[model samples]
Target: MDKYRDRSNTLAKERLTRETDKQASQNMAQWLEEFEATKDRVSEIKRVKSRDEDRYYELLDELEITPEYDRYEIIKGYKRDVDALTKEWLKATTPAQRDSCVQAIIGLKSDMVRELMNTQQ
Candidate 1:
């Protein structure tokens, strides 16, 4: 009877190990799927960003403004900074954070306007 009990215990242990391995394998597969999906999403976003950048340059050319122009380039830098700040503001969950973003954006816009005025004069 003792020998039979020992055999049963060994079989139970083996079964438990198999179940744990199965669960681990399933979890790894799910993680891989999620990783692949994320990779695809990043690739799509990069493509869209590339297109937007190309369009921006095209618009600049259409307007006859070369990037070599110092004043316009400075304004462009400010615009980029403001755009980033706007995105940050949109993502901010707290009012204080949003306010900070707004202030930064306002400052950038003010600087840009000042630069524009100087260029005009």
Candidate 2:
């Protein structure tokens, strides 16, 4: 009777583990799908002539960094630190300063794209 009880408990635990693993895999798949969708949307927005400023700001806000810095200063600092530690650039500067830098860089990049578009046109 003791052996039979132990065997049943082992089987039950195995079944539970299998179920948990399946659930975990399903959840991971769902998360990956969502991530891919988000990437696609970002790509589409970036391809537009007018990039989504709100979305860009939303991302900056999500990073918990303020968006208020001189574009050139931020670009200089970011370029210097990008290969090392981007988080440091965000950290060494004030929140508003950091935000300004980010906005400046984005604006610069957008201008460049616009120039390219005009050339192509």
Give the count of colliding residue pairs in each prediction: 0, 8
Root mean square deviation (Cα) for candidate 2: 21.9
* Model 2 C-alpha lDDT per residue in residues 55-75, reported as the tens digit of each score: 765664443332222222233
For candidate 1, write residues 1-121 as lDDT tens digits.
Answer: 9899778756754553344324434342343344455445445545665669776555545434422244445555665676676667656789999779766765665565555446546
TM-score per candidate: 0.42, 0.26
TM-score of 2: 0.26
State the weakest 10-residue window (summed lDDT) of model 2. Answer: 64-73
Cα misplacement distance, residue 65 of candidate 1 (Å): 9.2
lDDT of candidate 2 at residue 117, scale 0 to 100: 35
lDDT of each: 0.55, 0.43
Residue 28 lDDT in model 2? 29
